[model samples]
Target: MSESTKRWGLLRHHDFRQLIVAESISHLGSQITILALPLVAVAVLHAPPFQVALLMTFQYLAFLVVGLPAGALVDRMRRRRVLVAADLGRAVLLGSIPLAWALDWLSMPQLYVVVLLSGVLTVFFDVAYQSYLPHLVREEDLVEGNAKLEAVQNVAMIGGPAVGGLLVRLVGAPIAVLLDALSFLGSALFVGRIRSVEQAAPRPERTRIGQEIMQGLRFVLANPVLRAIALSTAWLNFFSAILESMILLLLARTLGLSAGVIGLLLSLIGLGALAGALSARRVTDRFGQRRMIWVSIVVTAPFGLLLPFAREGWLLWAAMIGWAVTYFGGTVYNIAQVSLRQALTPPNLLGRMNATMRFMVWGTLPLGSLVGGVLGQYLGVRPAMLVGAIGYLFGFVPVVLSPLRRTAPAPVGEVADDLPGSEQPVRK
Candidate 1:
C-alpha cells in the first residue's frame, strides 16, 4: 500500500472518529482525576507530605507488579470489552470517594484503596487499548491514529488540570474527584456504543504462569530496540518522578507560586504536548519517525533541569515555557516510538509485548521518586533537580549509541534486531 493511500483511508474512516471522541472524553477525565486525587490526599485528608507521596507509590505499584500479568489477561480476553469494563470500574471506584466523603467514611486508608483500584483498572485499560489499536485502523494509518489520540490527550491534560485547579478551589477536592468519576461514566457510555469486533489472538498452549511471565520478559530482553526504549522511558519517568514529589513543595515554599498558578503552568506543558502530537506524524513523515523519535527525545531531555532555574515572575514564566516545549517534544517522541513499535510488532504477540514493555516503562517511576525524596531532603530541591536532569538527559544515550538512529521501517517482525529471534522465547 502506498503512503498516500494509507493516509487517505485513515482520514475517511468514521470508526476512528468515534474511537477518538470516546477516548478524548476518557483522557480528559483521567487528567482531572489524577490532579484531584492528590489534592484529596493533601488538603482534605490532611496527609503529611511524605504520606501524600505514598499515594502515588501505591497507585503505580500495579504498573510494576501486575503490568505483565494484566497484559496477558488482555491478550486472552476481548480487548474492547476490557477497555469498557476498566472505564466502568474506574467510574465506580472513583464515585465511591465522594460517597465516602459524604458519609464521613472517606478516611486516608480508604483513599489508598481507591487509588490502588484505579491504578489496577488503568493498567488493564492502557494495555488492552494499545493492543486493540491495530484492529481499529488500517495498517498504514497507525501512526496518524496514535498521533491524533495523543493530541486529544495532550489537550485534555492541559484542560483537565486547569479545570481541576479551579474546581478544587471552588468545591473541595473530594467533590472534584466526583467530576472525574462522572467523566469515566461518560466515557463508558460512548465506548459501549462502539461496535468493532476485536478479533482475538490465538492463545498459546498452557504453561505455568511463571513461564508466561518469563516469556514476555525474554521477548523484550531479546529485542534491543524494545529494551532500549523501555529502559529509556522508564528511566525518564523515574528521574522525572524525583521532581514530581518535590515540585509542589518547591513552588509552594521556595518559588512562592500559588496552586492555581502552578496548575496553569502544568497545563501549558500539556498544551505543548498536544502541539507536538498534532505535528508528530507530519514531522515523522517528512523526517522519518526514527529520526524524529531521537530528536524529540534529545530536545525534551532536560525536563528536570528546568526546575532550578525557575524564579518568581518572568523568570518562572520563561522556565515554564521552556519546560512546556520539552514536554511537547517528549509527547511527539512517544507517539513515534509507540507507533513504530505497533507497526513492527506481530499481531499475535501484541498484548504480551505491550504488557512487557509497560512493566519496564512504568515500573521505574516510584523508585525514582523514592530516590528523589531522599535527595531532595539532603541536597535541597534545586540541587536535586539539577542532578535528576543530568540523569534524565541520558535517555538519549541508548539511541545515540545504537542502530535505531539510522534504521528504516521493515515489515512487522522483521525490523533489525528489535525483536526476539522468535517471539515468546523464555527469558531468565
Candidate 2:
C-alpha cells in the first residue's frame, strides 16, 4: 500500500472503527475508575496513605508477575478473544465492588483483590490489543490510527473524570464504578461485532516456556533503540508514579480541595494530553520521529518542576498549568514511541514485544508508588514531588546516548554480544 492510499479515512475501515470505538469506551471507563477507585479507598474504606498507594501498586503488580507468561500465552491464541475475555472479566470484577458496597461488606482487602484481578486482565487486554492492530490496518496507517485513537482517548479522559466526580458526589463512588463496569460491557459488544477475520498464527510445536520468554527478552535487549526506549520509559514511569501517587491526596488533604475541584484538575490534565495527541502527527512530520522522541521530553518535562510550588488560592491554577504541560509532553512522547515500536517489531513477536516492554516499563510503577507514599508520609508532599520532578529531568539521558537521536528510523534486529541470536527460532 502506498502513502497516498493509506492517507485518512481510517474510520471507513469497519474493523478498525470497531476497535477504535471499543477502546475509546474502555479508556473512558478506565479513567472514571482511576478517580473513583482511589476515592473509594480513601473515603469509604478509610485507607491510610500507604494503603492507598498499595491500591495503585496492586493495579500494576500483575505486570511483574504474569507479564512474561501472558505474552507467550497471547502469542498462542486469538488476540480478539483475549480482548473480549479481558473486558468481560473486568466487568464482572468491577461490578462486584458495587455489590459489596451495597451489602455493606466492602473491605480493604476485597478492594485490593478487585484491583489486582482487574490489573491481570488489563495486562492481557493491552498486550493482545497492540499486537492485533497491525492485522487491522496497513503498516503506513499505524501512526494515524494510533493518533486518532489516542486523541479520542484523551477526549474521553477529559470528560470521564468530571463525570466521575459528579457521579461520586451524586450517587457515590461505588455507583460510579458501576458505570465503568457497563462501559466494559459496551466495549465487549463493540469488539465482538467486528466482522474482520483474525487469522491465528499456526500452533508451534512444544517448547520450554522459559526459552520462548527469553526470545522476547533477547529481542528487546539486543535492539539498541528498543533498549533505550525501555530504559527511558521505565525511568519516566517510575518518577511519574511517584508524582501521581500523591496528587489527589495533596489536593484534598493539604490544599483542602473538594472532589469536584480535583476532578476538574484531572480533566484539565487530559486537555493538555488531548492537545498533544491532536498535534502528534504534525509535530512528528515536522521534527522527524527520531528527534521528536527526545525533544518531546526535553521541552515539556520541565513543567513538572512547577508542581511542588503550587499553593491554594490563585496558585492552584499555576499547579494545574504545570500538570497540563507535563501531560502534553508525555502524550506526544507516547504516541511517537509506541508507533516506532510497532513498526520495528515483526508480527510474530508483537505480543511478546509489547508484554516485555510493559513488564520492564510498567513493572517499575508499583515500587515507585510505594516509595512515593512512604516518602510523602515522611518528607512531606511538596518535597516528595520535588524529588520526582528532578528525576523526570534525567529520563532523556538514555535516548540522547542512543541511535534514536541520530537516525530517522533506528535499526532493528541487531542482537548484542551478551544475548541470544537476533533471529527468534521457531518453536516447532
Candidate 3:
C-alpha cells in the first residue's frame, strides 16, 4: 500500500473526517432533543399519555409518509447536497421552537408541527448520509469507518443528555432546544466543507419512480441476509419503541425521579453503546458477522424482562441494568448489520437499500409508541413494559429461521452479484 494511503485511516481521510465531524455534532444535538422534547410535552404542554405518544409519532411519521419516495429521489441526486439541505432545514425548524417560546407563542400544535417537519428532513438526511459513506472510504474500511463514527457518536450521546437535563433543570425545556438547533447548523457547515465530488451514476434508461422504489424493495426481499435483517430489526424496534415511550414519564411521574437522575440513567445506555462501539469490530471478528447479529439480540433482549420489575428503591437498579444490557446488544447488532448491509449492497443501490430497510425497521416505531401509550394508559406503565419485553424475547425468530444464522462475512463486491434479481434492476 502507498504510504499516503496507509496514513489516511478515517482520521486522516479528509472527506471522512468531515463526515464524522458532521455526524458527531448531529448526534449530540439529537440526544439533547430526545430528552428536551419529551420534557416539553410532559412539563410545559401537559400532554396526556396518548398525546405524548402523538408527539413521538410525529417525530417518526415521516418514515412512513415519504420514505420510499425519498429513497428513489436520493438515488437520482448528489447525496451530499441532500444532506446539507436536510441539516439546514432541521436547523430552521428546531430554531423556531426556541423563538416561539421566547415570544410566548409556543403551543402543542406548533411543537407537533415542528417535530414532524424535523422528522421529514431527518428522513432525507439519513438516506443520503448512509449512502454517501462508502464513497468517502475504501470498501474494506467501511466497518472501521462506521465504528469510528459510532464511537464519537456514543460520546456525544453520553454527554448530550446529561447536559440537556441540567439545562432543562436550570433554564427550561424550550431553551434547551436552541442548543440542538445550533448543533444542526454546525453539522451543516462541516458537511458542506467536504470536498468529495459526488455525481449520480449514469444509467442507460431511466425508470419510473414506482419501479425504482419497487426495485429497492425487491432487492432487499430477495436477499436472504437483507430480508432477515429487515424482519428481525423491524420486530425489535417495534417492541423497543413500546418500552422506551414510557420510560421518561415512568421515571418522572411514578418514581418521582429528578431530571438529572433520569438523564444519568439514560446516559448509562450511552455508556453501554460506547463500549459496544469500541468492541464491535473485535466481537464480530471473533464470533463471525452473521452469527453475532442474531446472537446479540437473543442474549441481551431477555434482560428487558427486568425493566418492569424496577421500582423506587433499590429496584431501580434493575431497570438501569436492563437498559445498559439491551443497549449494548443493540449497538453491537447495529454495527454488524449496518456494515454488512453497506458491504453487500451495490453502490448504485445503497440509498434505496438503506431507505427500504429503514422504512421496514423504523416505520414500526410510531405504531409501537402509539400501542405503548395505549397500554400504559389502560394496563399501567409497568405492565405495558412487561408486554414489550415479551415481544423482544420473540423478535429474534425471523432472523434465526433464515440463512443468516449460518452465514459468514464476505467482501462487498463479491456478495451482491449472487443475490437474486440483482441483475434485473440495471436492465429495467
Per lDDT, the best of the predicted structures is 2
Candidate 1 vs. true structure, TM-score: 0.90
TM-score of each: 0.90, 0.94, 0.94
| lDDT winner, 2 or 3 | 2
Q: What lDDT does candidate 2 reach at residue 311?
A: 90
What is the C-alpha lDDT profile of model 3 across 332-425, one tens digit per residue? Answer: 8898899889888887788889899989998998899889999998989888888888898888789889887766544444555653334423
**Candidate 3 minimal-lDDT segment of 10 residues:** 419-428
lDDT (Cα, tens digit) per residue for candidate 1, span 255-347? 765557756977988878888988888898998887877788787766547666788878787777777887887888899889977876776
TM value for model 3: 0.94
- Which lDDT values do the candidates have, in the order given? 0.76, 0.85, 0.84
- Best-to-worst lDDT order: 2, 3, 1
Better of 1 and 3 by TM-score: 3
